[model samples]
Target: MAPSLDISDWWVKETQKGTPVIVTTKNHNYSVVEINSPNTAFQQVDKDRGKKAKRLDLFACEEEKILNDVEPILLSTKRTLHNSSYNDGDRLLDEDQSWVLNNVFQHHPNKATKMGEKIDYVTVGKHDKYQGTRCFFVISTNSFRADFSYLKCLKNYVKEKYPDGVKAFNQKYFQKRRLKGMNQQQTGMNQQQTQ
Candidate 1:
């Protein structure tokens, strides 16, 4: 049996506040929050034996998964939900309890004759040093617009999804600096008037 990790030890303590820690699944890597549960087992394995299993609480961010698979391809981040105990059934190919997923090709359709040969959309995300934010950007091959416009769309998407988080960041960090500048200007004006 593989050693079970305590819930508290799952996260890196030193870097927890610095940046989001990424956990890699077999299909793709993503940001996840580890949630602990008392009744970890959701389903039963053996009907006759009445054996219960512990399930890990891995809440993955869907947006992060989308950002990683930017090319018009399908992505699967779902793995079997089991903790510590490794069973052959937990392997992704177990057809009895598992189903095959076609990922990207099933979702998007291209009418062109050489549709399979060309990519319609490209996925992209990066941390902007000037803006100090990270988000996903998609560029469409069919569209005549430039890539920068796509980035603007991506920024808006992130802001819409995380309005409160973005607002807090602006108020705490960016807006605070601007406020400081305004205060300095006022102080300078007062000193000039006094002189």
Candidate 2:
């Protein structure tokens, strides 16, 4: 759900001061799905989601189930949660239970699509990024416009006002920094190898 720009001066004000916000869902454990980003709150328009949307304590639900069902385990929060004192489920998919979903798609493609649609516990949907593979997004979105108009305006202004400044800064510090650093390290290693 994208919000229409009806209000001329509408902008998202940051509510959380970086002190860790919590979600409302009880079972989201990030096991089978990846919470790409668990943010983006919006006011609900419909009857069912209205209450949750208005709640100040709740954050926008974010989840992404890999179409291949082999979503990288690195993204899973299971280890971090289990190891940490904060065992509370952060509404991400449970990594421990993700073992059930590991080879569902590779071994059975047809079952994946069918299960995706009908299954209540496991969310199923067509993958937005990859074609033909079925992916599921369990998070229900709100009627809010997700855009970078604010960033776009800022970018345009910066581009117009400080083209040389950005270029110079990148040239001095940002541009090719990674490649240069890696090349230097590799060159040193090569020199050592030759010696």
Candidate 3:
């Protein structure tokens, strides 16, 4: 039998600030948090679990099973989602997911055509850096358009479904600083107006 978690150990430490520390022992990670009145943090965990259950149901649906033939398409989507640069309050767009999907489909058009399926849209959430985030999606073949449209659609669909957690994390550590460049044409026009 598994040992009960010591919930007190999972409390976010003052030194950790916004980041929660998770300790791994015997292959399991545990978080320490205070269990107090209302337990808003615990409530958030339940909400997340519910959302995950819903996504699993969608994955188990008959129409979605068609994507199984092109499972790699989904893997590729995961890779992209794990590699996106997102910030807090940033809204994920279907187009971003589509870009990754299109790349994957172009590489495996034949398999995609055989499956007759595509990804439609995805939902994602915010996080602090390359950490936990959720993604959800609606999958379909009918809405796919473009060369190898079916495959591209699936790729896009899966990508849009999940949050780009890993990418966001990496961004937090490796942010770049660069000066903004003015458009040459616009600058010239402004100069002329001033003259």
Candidate 4:
């Protein structure tokens, strides 16, 4: 029998190209978004407000608290990189390294195991629970951010905590619009009944 290829290595090789790596596992399609270089990701962050920004798209989910508390420096680095105008800053990357290690192996069970010293965002995959489908990937720019540890620490303390994107949007925008729509419907009904 021909030797089976390892999927994780395949994913690493594919993602290094800086393009979305799309693959099918268990009949589900997944698109791994663009992975940026560590240096470039940092540069993008530094170019912006220098970590003073309140929130970043990277920690835009409900899981932000866990990530923010565990590795605040890493969280800030990721947040600043995400807040920058650079189009290549990928927010789809997973926050937990072990999650990627576990899922990738599950999908490619026959593949050989070769562990990397560290896990980054590129190897990370995000699942779509709403759709019940495959996973999307994000690249890790840890090396680049490592250069700015002091800055990350300063930002975390001085700057306000990153806001919860999902909660804020729902409370501020979605809820208001929904209420307006309901009120308009009620007004229309009242007018028709009186007429």
Candidate 5:
């Protein structure tokens, strides 16, 4: 039987606020931070082990927190790339990663408007790892405002494209938004919301 899903509140909390984060995989004990910078590349720690050892460092302006938290799962599957095993094939990729990435991209804020343009976005790449478990690093562009706006647009775009997208989007957005709003309200942003 397949394993059950483990969804953590930590990942949702960080992503809703658009905060970049550092994710350390428990299985691999590998740590990486998602930042807003282009031109960053994933380093190859070893090349003898095949694709599972390779890591991709990518950049985008959106979903830094969500993406970082879900790295281990996004690339999970049963597919092979060269004659070697990867998260997608050998169960290296965590299932959680797939869930978060799929949900986030599908229902992100304002996703509809930025469907086809060169908007601020997030990009993922892959590399090789040795010694420990496979690892992937995420990067984002330097402009936070642009990235957030683009993500928002993308979310809306998806909603427009798919009839059921908005329903899910609304459910996810409101839950996180309410929590974040409460946190902000305590931090003295309550007055801003009323105005």
Candidate 6:
């Protein structure tokens, strides 16, 4: 028999070249979005391997801006890469309702797994969950604000994030101005909803 390939094995190696996904275990009736930050990447790494690995998108997309007198490339490591407010960081990504829940899931929360999540607004990538455990995917735009980290940072994001082409993505996924943009279905809704 042919060797079975892990779904994630087919996913792109870097989030920059694809849709840039952030995967987490499926939300429970009482999921805790931790806000007490480690204040540093190392500290964060020590807190939770999965969360830290998931944070690759945060640093790549959220912090991909020039802020606090530091380059977006994260050369200085002097910026407020993490927000103390859980609502601002993870909450913003998960709770905002802007992302699309997908089936393409990625595991290895202990490692930085970067890759484009196909051309969908959001979904669980790689798997229905991680390593036999139930999981979900937060599929947000690879189009991050290019103000934080510029040089050496997100160099591959623009060219590859949208594997299917930006214009097509925008037309297919973007909502109308009437919706004021984004969503807020607190139940961890799955599937992409373009309005």
Reference-based TM-score, model 6 = 0.15
- Each candidate structure's count of clashing pairs: 3, 13, 19, 6, 35, 32
Instruction: Write the residue-wise lDDT of candidate 2 on 30-138 in tens digits.
Output: 2122222223223333466453333312221221121112123322422432444332222224552343234222223234333443333323333333223223332
lDDT of 4 by residue, 1-195 (tens): 998544556565756676455665442122233335433432333335443233333333343453444345434434534443323324333443343334332233222222233324432122322112123233324442111122223233222344434344334323444576567667666766799
Model 3: per-residue Cα lDDT over 1-195, one tens digit each = 999654554554543456544554442122344544333545544455463344334332332333343355556665555555744323336676565544544444254553347555433443222123333232345753222223334444444443343233223212221011124335555766799
Question: Which residue pairs clash within candidate 4?
Answer: 121-138, 121-139, 121-140, 122-138, 122-139, 122-140
**Ranked by TM-score, top first:** 5, 3, 1, 4, 6, 2
| Candidate 1, superposed: residue stretches over 4 Å from native | 1-164
Q: Against the hidden true structure, what lDDT does model 3 obtain?
A: 0.41
Tens digits of lDDT, candidate 1, 73-153: 211211212222334223233331222112322222222321334434432232232222222222335542111222223
Supply candidate 4's per-residue lDDT for 2. 92
- The lDDT values for all models are 0.33, 0.33, 0.41, 0.37, 0.36, 0.28
Residue lDDT tens for model 6, 1-195: 998544343343442265534556533212234323223212333445463344333332323221212223233221222323322223234432231111012211211223243323322222322122112233335632111111112222322444334333233222231132223221223332332
Q: Which 10 residues in a row give candidate 1 its minimum summed lDDT? A: 50-59
Q: Considering lDDT, which of the candidate structures 1 and 3 is the better prediction for this target? A: 3
Residue 8 in candidate 3 has what lDDT? Answer: 50
Which of 4 and 6 is ahead in lDDT?
4
Looking at model 1, residue 77 earns an lDDT score of 15
